[model samples]
Every structure is written in C-alpha cells, then in structure tokens.
Target: MKMTDLILKYLSIKTEVKIPGFGIFQQKNVPAFYDERLAALLPPAKEFFFTEDFNLKDENFIQFVAKEKNIDINESYAEIAELVNYWKFTLQNKIVLEIPDLGTFYFNDEGNFIFKGKHFSTESPENFGLEELNLSELKNRKSALGKSLENEYKTSRNPFWWLLLIIPVTAIIYLGTQNPELIFGKKSFKNLKKTKTDSVVKSRNLLKDSTKIDSTKSKIPTPKLK
Candidate 1:
C-alpha cells in the first residue's frame, strides 16, 4: 500500500496522527446544534487540520501502523520515514502533492506552506445513519421519567416473545429424544398409555372366557360318548 493511503487511513479514526518530518493530522468534532431558521437540529460533524511546526515522530501512531500491517516496529518506522521523505522531495520539486481523502499540501514560492482540504459531507450514509432531527414534532410530546432506550424496548418487545422461540426449540428437543408424546401434553400422553393398558386387559379377559367354555364343552362331550 502507498504511504499516503496509510496516513489518510490513520487520520480517519484517530484524533491526531503525527509523522516525523511530515506533519500532524488532527480531527475536531463539531457537535450537533439547533438551526433556528430551519427549526431543526443539525447533526454533529468532523473537521480536519494539518500542522507542520513539529519534527518529532509519534511512536503510538507508528505502532498502530505496525499492528495494522502485521509488521515489526523497525519496519514500520522505515516505511513511515520513506513516505515522509517522498512527500518532502515531491514538494521541494514544486510538484503538486495530493493525498486522497485528505487534501493537497504544497509550498509556495515564498517558502510558505499551504494545505487545501476537500469538503466532506456530514449527511446520511456517511453521517452514521443520523437524521436531521425536527424539533417541531416534539411540541406535543409529554415528558416521561424513564430512559428512551428502555421505553423503546418495552414498547417494541413482546413479553411473550420467548414463548414462541421456546415452543419450537422444546419440540425439536423432544422429537430428537424420540419422545413426541411429551410434546403433545401430559394429558394426551397419559390417555395414550391408558388406552394401551385397557386393550391388553380386555384381551386377557376374553382369553379366560374362551378357556372356560372349552373346558365345559369337553366335560359334556365325554358323557355323550359313554
């Protein structure tokens, strides 16, 4: 990866990233504020600035690069130094030094430094999904005591939602265990067992009645033959 890309990426999430002999990149957060004319609350935004008054390398920033590239600190230091020298050499030759996502850095004829930054949007898709909050809609809202997140959860979540998940899970478990009758309710299981028991007892009684009839017939037939 190019050094400029690495530096721009580092500046994206960090408050300050300083490279030796290069410069310092800093980020400032502009808080959300109300727009009186629009009657809406503007979202918070980010601002970036560059400074070149210092000549010291930031070890923490170098370490971040080291970790990101999965390299040792020595390699990281060498890479940063090479990039810094390239930027300086480019500027010294009166060539336009452009860093993508940031802006351009160039020296004027009078030995003065100038940084021209591109404007970044603070709107939807890039604004972390924040919307322009309209306060007029809140005029009729009643103030409540609980937290908004808590209230939202209480309203949006169903108290019996767990039952829906639990029922299917329990059925799967019972069926996996080869006991589907347990899933049908204890009363149904008991009735099924009782029906099997009644059928067996009726079969035994019928067998006994047939045996008694057979013995009586045998006793009467022997007398007839005599």
Candidate 2:
C-alpha cells in the first residue's frame, strides 16, 4: 500500500499500538499494566513511559516501504521529510497527535513521540489557532489617521503662523502712520514731484533772464545809427 494508504490504515485503527522506535498508537482508557517488582528493581522505571521518536530521519522507513511496494519514491522522500519537520516544529510543545480516525501521535517535551487513537481532540483554543488579519485594512486605517493628524498639526499651527504674518504687516502700518515722510518722503514718490516742480521754476527763471537781456540789447540801440 502507498505510504499515504498505510498512514490512513494506521489512523483507522481504534487501538493503540507501538510502531517500534517511532512511537505508540493507542486509544484512551486502555488498560494500564504495571509491574511492581520491575518498578522496585529499577527505581527509574517508575517514571518510564512509552514514547515515539519520529524524526525526519524516519523517512528511510517510508523509502523502504516504497521499494517494497514497487512504488516510485522519487522526490517523495525529501517531501515527506520536510513535512515531518514542519509537524515537528508546529507541534513542538504538544504531547499527542490526534489524527482523526487514524490515531494520535504523542511527543514529549524532550521530543519523544507516541501515537494514540483518533477519538480524542487535542486542538488548541480558537484564539491560540493561527489568525488571519486583514493587513490592508490596518494599512488603510493608519494612512487615514496619519492624514488626519497632519491636518490637525497644520490647523494647530495656523493661528501662530497668522500672528507671525500679521505682526510684520502691523509694524509696517504703524511705521507708515507714525512717519509718513519716512515712507513717502523726498526720496520716494513726493521727491519726484518736487524735482519736477523745481525744474519748471528754473526754466521760468531762465526765460525771464533771457527776456531782460533782450530788452537791454534793444534799449542799447545801435549807436552806429547817427
């Protein structure tokens, strides 16, 4: 049978059986036999319990099975090894594996493996299970919050900024009102008007001087006209 089929068959078993070095397959409430004499002889036997050691290296057995069944193992060995590694890590702290209807595999904290019946469920709580949160929703919420915060910051600074702007304007107005000449003095627009008026006055004076000169020449009359 295919390894998958074998696993399925093993899973279907209701009783717990040991897969030798791998682990033990069993159901709950099975008879627990104790050897008092043996326990007494070996003090350490008191804590001794049956456990499996299912490691990635155990894929060799699967390969053997594949060869025996004349099935193409091909890349499946590595695949199976990877799968076992995933299970080992994922079920690190768990003591038992509950394969529905197949059986349960148990592993001690120290990495010893054991198998048991499938009737029991060793699933973790809902909260403990893997969670799938919407990262997009979180990103969008953060973006919106960021925009709102930016707007709030601008709004908070607006009053101070306006005050800063108004201060300069007010100072200018005050200075203009206190000393209009300082802004519109002779050096500014009024200076140009005054310059034009001075030019016109000078031209008029020149004209008057020229007219006086002409009258003096006329009064001098040509002395040669006997």
Candidate 3:
C-alpha cells in the first residue's frame, strides 16, 4: 500500500527500519508478567523505539518492499530514498513530521530527534483472552470454608459427656467411704427393719395365748439333759 504503511510492516517483520536522514525505527520486546489486578498472566509484547544513528536501508528490507510493490529492486530503493528525504524536509521545515500509524518525528526541547509511536497499544497477539477473577465468588468460598470448620468443631464435642463417666465414679467413691454391708451384707438397714417387725408380731401372739399358758409352754422346744 502506502510507503509509510510499508515502513511499519517492515518494522513488525524485521524489528527495525532505518530511513536515510530521519532515524532508525526499532521494536522492543516486553516479556510476559503476572498482572495482580486481573490476577492473570499477560503475554509478551512489542514496543517501539527510535534513534538517529545508522540511518541506512537494509538490503532484505529493500527487497521486501520491491516484491510487495511489484517493482524492481533499483526502483524500490529510489522510491524509499525519496520518501526518506521528504520526511527529513518536513521535519526540518514544518517543525514536525507524522507517519501514519507509525509515529511522529520531531525535535524535542533538547534538540534531539525523537519518535513517539501513534496508538501505542501494548496488546500482543500471543494472548488467549482470559477473564478477570471474580471477587464475590472468592468471598463466598471463604465463608463456606469457615462454616465447614465450625461444623466440624461442633461434631467433635459433646457438652454433657463428662457426666456419663463422672456419675459412676462418684457413686463408687461414696460407697467406699460408707459401711460395706449396705452393698454386700444381708443384715443391712432393710434386714434390721424386717427383724423389728417380726419381734412385734411375736409379742402380740404371746399376749393372745396368755390364758393358754400351759399349751404355750409345752409348744416351746427344749433340749434334753446330756
């Protein structure tokens, strides 16, 4: 297409383009890095730079232009030389020179020839589009993890569990400190109450037989003389 467009394409392909009397255009490599805000990995990229030294055309670059323009190499070289002179004349007389989609060439306050690329986008074709991290989903996962931990703590504990073992132990200790016969002997408080009731019944029966004293005396069992 246009000569300026061809210059840009050459920069993309060869990574450098040197124009007589203007400056040399070059591309810089920006390596991939992690982007914290997006929480994603960014791809390697290309950036532009310019210098005033070695403003000479490359043989392969000239050949590329010749092939693209469907012209001979000598014709291509002459056209490129004329374009370079036009760029230099514009910058020297008009105080600025603009190359469409490439950059603007001008003298800075330091009287240095400088190039600033137009529409300087850092987007690289090597990138596979990645979505940004969702903060809401991250917070939800954190809350769920906290709830899981709480449930696990609750499941591992029984509030009244100590009572199950303590009650039996306390009862055993109290019984040990008291009379052994309460738990192991037949003549305990239950046996004493039964004995008292039996004695009272025997006395009542004796009173009922007071008029039959001789019958009662004969009924009593006695041991014979040894």
| lDDT scores in order | 0.74, 0.53, 0.72
Per-residue alpha-carbon lDDT of model 2 for 1-226, expressed as tens digits?
Answer: 4444555444345233334234443344322232353331211111112345563134444555456566667655554456456556656756465544454566666676654332222233522433334455568889999999999999878888789889989988987999777666745344343368888999999999999999988885556755
**Model 2 ranges with Cα > 4 A deviation:** 1-4, 10-50, 54-60, 64-71, 93-97, 105-115, 119-226
The best candidate in terms of lDDT? 1
Q: Write the per-residue lDDT of candidate 3 for residues 65-123, one digit (tens) a residue.
A: 89999999999888888887777777667478777777777787877667875433355
Name every residue pair that clashes in candidate 3: none
Runs with alpha carbons beyond 4 Å of true place in candidate 1: 29-45, 123-226
TM-score of 3: 0.45
In angstroms, the error of model 1 at 219 is 99
Worst 10 contiguous positions by lDDT, candidate 1: 185-194
Local error of candidate 1 at residue 209 (angstroms): 99
lDDT of 1 by residue, 38-96 (tens): 68886766656788744775687789889888999999999988878887888777788
